[model samples]
Each structure stands twice: as structure tokens, then as C-alpha cells.
Target: MQDNGPSLVCAPPAADARSGIVLGEDALTVADAARFAREPGDVPIAIGEDAALRMDASVAARDRLILMRRPIYGVTTGFGDSARFHLSPEKTTELQRNLIKYHLNGTGPSAPVDVVRAAMLVRANCLARGYSGIRRGVVELIVDCLRHGITPVIPERGSVGASGDLVPLCYLADLLMGSGTARVDGEPVPAAVALRSRGLDPVAFEAKEGLALINGTSFMSGFGVLAVHDAEGLCAVADLGTALAAEALMGNRSHFEPVIHRQKPHPGQVRSAARVRALVRGSDLCLDTPQVLEANPDVDGLGVIPLGRPIQDRYSVRCAPHVNGVLADTLDWVRRWLDIEINSTNDNPLFDFATGRVHNGGNFYGGHVGQAMDSLKLAVASVGDLLDRQLAMLVDTKFNHGLPPNLVRRVDPGDPAAGLHHGFKGMQIAASALAAEALKLTNPATAFSRSTEAHNQDKVSMGTIAARDARSVVELVTEIAAIHLLAGCQAADLRGAHLLGLGTRTGYEVIRDHVPFVDHDRRLDEDLGVVVGLIRSGALVAALRPHWDADV
Candidate 1:
């Protein structure tokens, strides 16, 4: 079959718009990223796109070096700890091939299929820039792999976040050389068979092609892309959850009053507060009187004095915007960093062969991505923690004001427990466990580094770990938010209140549509799965987009 065209992968707009350096466009909004998942053949790869000219210039300089007698490090000699070794013209090819083979030492479980695909796509794009002294044929081969779904089985471990994502990328290089393993039609096959099945030969590594392939932060960038994409979803979910919690608690909507956010003037805080206000708009529960005062007519309840339940709610309910606001700020910072990384030429020995200067530098270091991922993970964890606390409040009779214990089906018709039983006991436990895992993963991986390879890689970025952790935290937060959604929907259903914020009511209805109220306890995993699927599929995000867009 002819190679399919560029797929509509949904990467963020900022990350996808630029070119040259790999990683442009937000990973979340990139349409058809799976099209670039391996390497496509028909897609036109260029070096001098309007957005990537600087990188193109850098690569052109390297090509100029091959015409000169100057001994560029990887172009003419050797690489890495092997930079001192010079290769003869006949042996240069062998040197390049060996470089890829030696680096294919990654271990541990295979990375997610999407991440592996993204890594291959990024590597090919970097090569297409032409700065790496790689043959255009090599770039085409990589693209062809993407088009054909020939994803190399890259291991998740072994990258120290320095000298690029060498270890995992080595596996990718090996597959291209017909020496490693690849997934053909979703089945693991020998590299040689996989290449042969596509009627292709092993890619012959040229001068710096191996180094170029293995010597970038594609592993970290892949995770960064995936995490940032998912984080956007988590942020939206957080907004939805906060709205639900606010309505359920019957807290002051004045806290989200636009004027309150305007005074603070922080963009994220302002956005978050505004989102909360929008979600709770038209909420009858938000306007409902406290049950304690509503139930008692004569006990110190003068007709002149309006009866109210508790004077105040717990901090989790009252201070939701303050908690989720931090996450909004963190997401902004991550988005900025990801945008820069995606558009940056983060390769080593940056080929300025044009200036007769091959500057072997630490441009490939993933410290920026590392710190950003760590910060994002922590922020996400905090959101998860907040959601967990909110869910707890919903289920606990002592905390819910008048709601049933566990938000369950009550036993007696007239009794507070009549129709409700513990609706979310198992879900609450699961949410708490997910939150705890998220919290444990929040320790900044950037700070926990061990100098490896005889201290040559003394300062490690641990950026891949950070990105993976952030992705994990995003998943955990999504689950927590789903639990909150379930609880909030149940509460709203039990109360029979008509008014709900436009966005929040939509979220509640979406949840109700997927997993009906737990009138009787059945299989909880099935319900949880439905929620997870909805969140991952961006159902909730789609539901709330109009309200958020209008408010913004």
C-alpha cells in the first residue's frame, strides 16, 4: 500500500507549529500523531521550513564540513568517550554501525507503544533537518517505518537522561539496522524479518547518523509530550471536580467571583477562579440553605433569622480554587518548557561545521524538561490529593453535612439512610490509593541522580523518569477526579436539585450516562473503567469546553 499521509495527531498548538528541532506542537493537540508514529515515506521532510531555518542553517554548516579537511568529531573521527579515536575512510562506516550497536543496551519493560512511535518520529524529524550529517535515505527509512507501523521495541529503562536518550534510542537504531526487535502488526518479530517483510534492507549507519539517532532527548521528550497532553485533560478534570465539590458542599460561590480573581491578577489563578464560577453557574445546590437550619423550625430559629446548616465547610471544600490554582500555574510553566524543547535542536556536538566549528556541547541535557516534569507531577499530585479529600468529605456523614454516610443507598424511607447505601466506599479507597501513589511519585527525580559510566555522565537529568512520573500522576489524578465526579453526581441525584452550573451539570450528566447511580453495589471496577475511559477519551473535556471558552 502507498504510504498514508500525515496523521492528524493532537499535539498542543504551540508545540506543533514550529519546525527544525524535533518536538514542535503540543503533544495533546497534534492531529494524527500516530501517522508520524513510525516514519512515513511520502511526507516531505525539509531542512529549511520557515520555523526551523536556524536549525537548518546549523545542519548546512555540518554538510559543508564534509567538503573540507577539518576533523569534525563524529563526522570524521569517533564519538562519546571514544572521541579520541580517528577512523580511516574505509572503517568510518564500521565505526558508525558499532556506535549504534554498543548503545543498544537498554533494559526493562518496553515503553508504551505511542511513546516508542513518538520517539521514532522525533528522531526522523531531527535527521530531516540535515544538520546531523546523516544521509537523506536514512531519514526516509525512518519515516517509512512510521508509515508502516514498524515500531522498534524500545525498553523503558537505562537512559540516564544525559548524552540524549542513548540507551532506548539504541534499540531503535538496532531495529533500523535489522539487528534488534520490532513490532510488526502488533506482534514482536525479529528485526531482519520485520525489515524484509516491508521489502527493505537494514539502514547502513553513516558518519553521525547513529549518534544523531541516539544522542537526543527523544525518550524524555516523548514522555514529556504524552504527559503534557494528558495534563491538559487533568486540568480540565480538576476544574470539573472543583465545581462539583463546590456545589455539593454548598460553599460560597463568591469566592470564585470574577472581581476576586482580577485583584490577584495571576493568569492561572484568574483562569481557575473563573472556571470554578462558570461550572457552578445556575447551580441550585450552590444556592441551597444549610440543612440543619432548614430542618429545625423553632429551635433558636426565629422566623426573622434565616436557618442555615454549618457556618462553614472544611478547607478542602472551601479552598478548592486555592489548591487547583497551583496546578493551573504549573501547567502553564510545563507548556512553555515543552514548547521550547519541542522546537529546540537538543543534539550534542551541535553541527556548526559551517563555521568550521563543531561545538560539542551539553545541549542534549534534559534538565529543563526534568525540572518541568517534576514540577508538573507534584502539581498534579496535589490536585489528586485535593480530589481525594473532597471525595472523602462527600462519603463521610460527619463531613457531608446532611448527605448519607459513604454516599450510599439509604436503608429506611424516612431515615437518613433510607434509599442510600455506601455508594462510593470501594471507589473512595481506590481514589485514596491512587492519590497516595501520586504523592509518592512527586519526589523530584531531577534531584535523585547517580553519576554513571565512570562519572563521565556525572550530572544526570533524570528527565525521562520525571516525565514518566508526571504521566503516572496524571493518570492517578484522572481517577481521583472520576471518583469525585461519581460522588458529586450521586449527591446531585439524591438531592433532586434542578439548578446546576452549565459545565458542572454537563459533567454530572456525562458521568450518569456512562455509569448509573450505585442504587445497589455491583462490580465497582467496571464503573471505574468507564470513568477512566471517559476521561482519557476527552469526553469530560469536550463537555466543559464551551463553558470554559465562553468564560475565558
Candidate 2:
């Protein structure tokens, strides 16, 4: 037999060459998960030195129970409705193996690689809490797969968010045991082959190891964390968009004044208003309603009082904070919930080594996650709907003040494409379509929850579905925001970018770097893609956030 040097499977993440996040050592934030989940290679993952010891204690506690012949769910007895069917001591391994094998019936397309990686990281973090009776070796197997850039082909569907994410996570169990499929550079390949290529062998499941592996809210919480991160960024960019729209429409700046929002003072609304003010600081484009009213006071019998511009912007421009703020507030609670869920010991029939007792409970139920994501879907779609409306007003000549129809720019009036040009017209329609789809998905997935796996598993939390739906809404809304941003940038070009504020001017330049000014009618789908990428990557928000450091 030829030697392949060291087995990548058993290599310690701590021993890896890069500085990175330590699971079980500290609380994992959404920011940490985002950095690692997107590119696992950039940030290495390591288990804390004490994490293995904790797993050892859990295993020992479980061993003492089995030695005494005491009954336990899924360990000494059958699962779900068959909890009454006790098995012989020798069948413990088979019980765990059957748990993984049967749930392999997960239906749906394989999840994206980033999602799979995030799920794996979250699951490992849960087991690291060391209440799941997982062996140190099984935890290492998961870490090894991540370190070697091998992600399982877990299905996106299945799992009722109770009894853990059993079906989808079963694929993870299969890869750990070397049976199912894994993605090798985004292409499907046999798990065994992938493992062997990395100079590793498939793990043999222990008594409660399979139950430990598949029993948690890893999939739901993992995807939830990512969605929440994007939603948060989108909130910031929405403020930036509001600033640009206010300038483009020559709308009233009084609408975003600190004194006005201070009266109502919802934390999100206050902060959003402050962010917009900071972004629009030193701008000459937006109107001051007080100045307009004072300068044009009626002199002859309450004459028409021609102030020229409208006294206030439309709701989409004026109430942007109110729309985006709801999601911002939603994230305030959602982040805390997800942090708890991911760091939780969600295992059923948990072993407490400190007290030498076994406690059975339903910690695997993801009710909090379901409600958070359901609310996230609603709040996020509202932002998209608002942006869609903003885009609507931007493209219409009647509402856009003095801007050309559809924001069409005729550099050479007689250059032949004069009336032929229809700039930003198609992008507006696409934004509307995206906003509609996003609104449709907001019909709470949790509201339609149904029973599954017999009457024993009644009242399941459809949190996984809700999380997936939230992710879809975020993606759709991101595209919608992208279109709004592109249109807002075009509006800036029409209204004179030189008149933009310090923050919006900086924002416009950054966008113009990626997408040039639309001079003529051309293929815009690619431009939309580029801008969408910028939004999701958080680069756009990063460029504009520093200017808001003091204000928000």
C-alpha cells in the first residue's frame, strides 16, 4: 500500500496554518459565521482543548446508563411512535445506524455549498457543547471534512424542525460514515472517494452518535444566520438609497429631521433617520420645507405661493426608515435568538455528566427560529416593496420632477437614438416582479405547519422551511434593492452628481466604478447581476457606513 502522508480527516483545525474562529471556545456571531461559511479556506475552524473532554464526559455518562440497563429514548428503545419498543443491548449500534439510513430519503435539490458548510459548522458547534454524547472522533470527522473543503450534498428540504433536522442532516451523517454524496469543488462525487482522496477513512457510528449528528437546528439556524447578516446590510444600504432618492427627487429634507423622529423614537426609525441625515449632509439638492415656505410666503391675498418643488417626498422616499427599520429591529432580536440556537445543546435525551443524570426533553423544536424567520420574511419583503415603489417613482416623468422620461440620457440629441432610448425601463419592471415574488413568499411558512412521523411527532416547527423562505426573500429583495440603487445612481447623474452630499457622492462613485452611467439602451441584466453581487457582498454598505459612524 502506498502512503499518502497525513490523513486530512484527522488533522486538527488548531494545527492549521491560518488564524480563525474557535468553535466551543467562544460564542459564534453571525459575522464570524459569514466570514467562515463563505470561504472555509480563508478562516480555519478549531475545537477548543476542553471541548473533547466535555464530549468524553457525555459518552461516559451514557455508558453508565446502558451498563445499568436503564431505558432511554433512541438509545435503548425505538424512536418516534415506537418509543415503547425496547431493544437488546447488542442492537444499540443498529439503532443508531437505522436512524441515519432511514432518514436518507430526504427529497429536494442539494443545498448550496456555502449553506452546507455553514450547516456543518453550526452542527459541530452544537455538539461541541458536549451534551449530545458524541464521540470526539465524530466531531473531528466533521471538522476534517470542512478543513479539507469537502461539503456533503445535503438536500434543501425535509426536517420538520423537530427531532432535530433529521432528514437533511442525515446526508451529513452519511458523509461522516462514508456513504452518501459530497460536493468536490461544486460537483457531486461519492463520499467514500472524497474521503479516501483526502487520505481519510469513513467513521463507524457509535451508540448515540448518529442521533447526535442529525439531531439539531443546524440547517435552519445556519441559513438563518446568513440571511440575517444580509438583511442587516440591506438595511444600511436602504438608508443610502433613501438619501440618493431624496436628492434625485429634490424632496424635503425636513422629513428625516432628528426632532421629527425623536417624537416617535422607535430605535430603528431613529437610527435610520440619523443614517440618512449623515449620508445627505452638505447636500444642496434636497429642499428644506421651512426655507421654501418662508421664502415664498403669500404676499397678495394668499396667492398660489409657488415653492416650485413639492413640500414632501412620496412615502417610499420619506418613510424608508419606517419600512427598513422594521427589519432592522427584527434583526436585533433575531440575532440573539440565532446565537442561542446555534450555541445550544439541542440534543434529545441529553446526558448531564455533572449530575450523572439523563434528561429527556424537546429542545430540538425550533419555535423561536420559525417565528424569527417568519417575521424576517415579512419585514424584508416590505423593504423590497418599498424599493420597488421608489424605483417606480424614479422611472415615471410625472413623479421624477424634471428628469427625462425613464431617466433616458440623450448625450447627442440628434444622434438618431433620441426617442428610441428607454433607459432603466426594463430594470424597473424586473424590480417590480422581484418585489411581487418576495411578497408572495412572506406568507408565513410556520402558519402552515403540519404533523409528520406519526401522531407522536405532532406539532412540528416548520422553521427550516421558514429559514429557506427568508433566504429567498433576502435574495429577491437584494436584487430589488440593486435595481433601486442603479436607478438612484442614474437619478444622481440626471440631477448632477456634483450636488450630492459627502456620503451619497462617495456612494455614487463606488457604484459608478462597477457600473458605468447608462448612456444608451443596452443589456442591463449583467449590470444588475454585478450590482446585486456588490450588495450581497456587503461592500456597498462598507463603503458608506463609516460616514455614518457618528450619526447612527
Candidate 3:
């Protein structure tokens, strides 16, 4: 049913917070889902008219198959290894209810509210495609919960990414029946109470309704969407950090020159280099090749006049585009794959009205998300390592040109407290620790697939674990990027913020406003956290946006 999905990924407009977000057989962008997930007040959900028609027709097909009393997977027969067992039509509803009850085995921490909300939206979108055969009213109940801001407390763990993230999805299904816990405005409450207070009633499971709700890739896809979104932002922030570091080190700007990237011309590399160049457009501190050569020109015909400093910067400063380029390029394809996975009807026993057949298959497998997230985390961690190295160079005396050692805030040479203060040294150590942790998680989660469900599902996707790991890496790298930015801003201050490049000056001022210069040793843990907030909220990148194109 998937025809290479959408070939393009132009981000759709942000979902209107006041107006309802429309869920149908259409594309839902990362920006839109993120908006709906975190918008403070309740945002309504609307089922598209065509999607409603499709849902109606699909339910009709399910009823038609039941009339003949034929055996259909999860409809008349038992689930998993018990499929050999048969059931009467009267008992199918009971079987479905039992399905939800048995799989309430999810354990560990509750998923973040954003992940939960995004999962709910993605699941509703899948059903809106009209192949799952769920009752239209049941689907409406799910939408109403979203509209009323009642999100199920799904565990972040316990999903193997096969058989439709069974454990976590079971919790979501149970919520529909008003039997689980939900969060209202960030406070936990009984699902029954939340629904009742919002004027919604508990839904009873019908023949296929429970199975339809609990079977799909919603959990993994939700995390993937957010991870991809954050990874993109991290890449841009990394470039800004590079620009700031270049200015602080008085490094050569020739590395990001258009002609250098033009030779290779990988889209990501080209764009990444462009962003750095644009950020440092009119800077005097970062010297061009000719400027450095002119300053150290040979005075006599004797070869070898000491240039004092190296002609080029280290790899972390010079090869940043190649590193961040991989992430930017990986996102292009990952977005395409997620476009297909989220929009697909991935539940089992799909009802196809055109051929008058109820097809039972393995559409619920989440291999695509698993692989995409694994690849994404690997790239993000690499960028984190790159940013860490950049931060390392920004503070060290051997590498930071003539900047103060450890970027100490210009204490007089012989002052009693001059040698006692250490600035950003602790931040560099913290960044290294975070970078190591992020790298450790890059090992593929999909490679550790387990055999379960009585071996009825012998091979599994493990996509959910991978998506979660990717989210972890993105988060850790965000902290690393924060430290990198703080150090970059500190280094820029040492060199005089006014001398920073056009775009980097804007980034410098934004960071400096929140965190002033450290005249002496002080607790900077709070400063790290504040910059982390700036990075995640896109505030740092947004400040630089006026100087560069929005796409950067």
C-alpha cells in the first residue's frame, strides 16, 4: 500500500494552537506534531472528512467478514502462539479486552509528556487512514482525550518495537477504557476521573477495536520525530559554536570557503560550510589565508621563516562541516522513512475494501524506525564529540592563540586570587563526560533483537529501544552543545565580543545576557543548565537566524 511514500519533505505550517490539528490521510510534519505535543493549553483534534469515510467503510468490511463466521487472525482466532484456538463471534470482544489486560506489563519510568502526546497523535493518524477497522466512535474517544489534554502515562521502556510496541500501547488502550492513569496539565490523575471531569465516557472494546489500538509503531515513531527535530537543531548550533571558536582562536576562515566545499559538494557539507561562513561573515579576529600569509611572509631568500602559529586549525575546527554534514544528510532520508512509517496502516489484519479481503500480515514490524534512529544517534554522538573537541581547543592555552589560560576573566597578573580562578575548566570536564556517555549508546539496539511471544514472533525490530537511545544521545549532546556555546561565548568575550563575526555577535549577546562574565570562580552548574535551555528552545539559533537564512 506504500508507494515509496512522499518524495519530498517540505515542513508543513505549524499546527494552530487555537484551531484544531487535522488528522487524516495526509502528511504530518515534525514541527506540527511538536507544537501539538507541548502547547500549554488544550489543542483540539479534527478527523478529516475523507478519513471518516474510510474508517466507516473499513468497519463495514470487518462486519461483513464476521457474518460468514470465517477465521480471521485476532478476530475469530487466538493471538500469537494461540492462533490455533478458535472463537465464536460473541467471544471476539472478550478476547480483545483480554488482549489489553494481559499486556499491561509495561514497567519503568513514565514517558515524557511530549512523547506520550506525540504517540497519541501518531496512533490517531494511523487509524485515520481507515485500514485498521476500529470503530469510528472509538477513534473519536481517543481524539477527545487529546482535545481535553488527558495523556496516558505510557512507560518509556518495555517496547521491543515489534508486535506494535505491545506493552506501552496496551497502556494507551487501557486508558480508552478508563482503567489507567493519565496526566492532566502535568498532574497525574485517574483516567476515569479525567474522562468523567471532561464529559467523556469509557469505551468498551469491540471485536477488533482493542487490537487496533494496541498494535503499531506509534511509540518509536514519536521519539524518532522528536529526535530528528533536535538533531537538526544541534547541527545548526554546532556550526555557531564553530564560528565562535574560530573567532576566539583567530583560526583561518579559508576552511569554510565556498570554493573548498564546492569541490566535494555533498549537500549537507555544502550547507554546513555555508552556515559557518554566513555566521562569521565580517569578522576581523578570524584571519583569511592571505592575511595569515602576509603577516608571516619571508624577509630574505633563505627558506623557512618561522610563521609562529600553524597555518591551519586542527580537525575539530577545520573538519566540522564533514562531521555535522553527515547528520544533516542522514536527517533527509530519515525524514522520508518516518513519513512512510507514521502515515502507514501498520496494525495487523488490515481490512482492504477494494479486494474484499481482510489481509493479516507483519505490517506492525518497526525495522525502519529502528535502523533510522540507530544511524541518527551515531551521527549525533559524533557531532557531540566534535563539539567537545572544539570546546577543548577554546579553553587550552597551547591552542587558544593569545587568549587567557582557561579563559580566566583577566585578573591582574600578581593579584592574590589571579592564579586561583579556573573558568570553564569544569565545564570542559563535564562536556567530555557527556560526550563519552553519548558515544557509548551508539551501538545498534536493533542488533540485540530478542525472541519472545512464545517464539511466535521469532525475530523482532527493537525499534523502540533504538528510538529511546537516540533520544538519549540527542539530549546528552544538547548539554555538550550548551557547554560548547558557553565556552565559545566566554572565549568571544576574552577576544572582545564586538570583534566577533556578524551572526556570532548576535549569538554572543544572547548568551551573555543570561550569563555574565565570571570574574572569579563561582557555581556554573546553573549557567550550564540555562544555556542548555537556550539551545533546546532554539533561542540561540533563532538569534542568529536574522543574519543567515532560516533553513540554516
Q: Considering every candidate listed, which one attains the maximal lDDT?
A: 3
lDDT of each residue in 299-374, candidate 2, tens digit only: 5787565656567778998888888788888889998988788878887888887777889999988888999999
TM-score to native of every candidate shown = 0.86, 0.94, 0.95
List candidate 1 segments past 4 Å from native: 1-71, 75-78, 288-307, 413-421
Instruction: Summarize candidate 3's per-residue lDDT along 1-552 as a digit string, tens digits.
Output: 332123311233345656667676565666667667767355667877667777887888898998889998999999989999889999988999999999998889899988888888889988887888887788888888888888899888888888978899998999999998988877899999989989999999888888898889999988988898888888889999888888888989999998999899889998999999899989988888888887776758877667765679999989999999999999999988987888788899898765568998998999999999999999999999999998888889888888888888987779888789998888899999999999999999999999998999889999999999999999999999988988888888778888888999989889989998877889998998999898888888888877879534
62, model 3: CA deviation in Å?
0.5
- Higher lDDT: candidate 1 or 2? 2
Q: Tell me the tens digit of each residue's lDDT in model 1 across 391-420.
A: 988888777768777777656777864654
CA error at residue 525 for candidate 2, angstroms:
0.6
Between candidates 1 and 3, the one scoring higher on TM-score is: 3
> What is the Cα-based lDDT of residue 71 in candidate 2?
80
Q: What is the C-alpha lDDT of each candidate?
A: 0.72, 0.85, 0.86
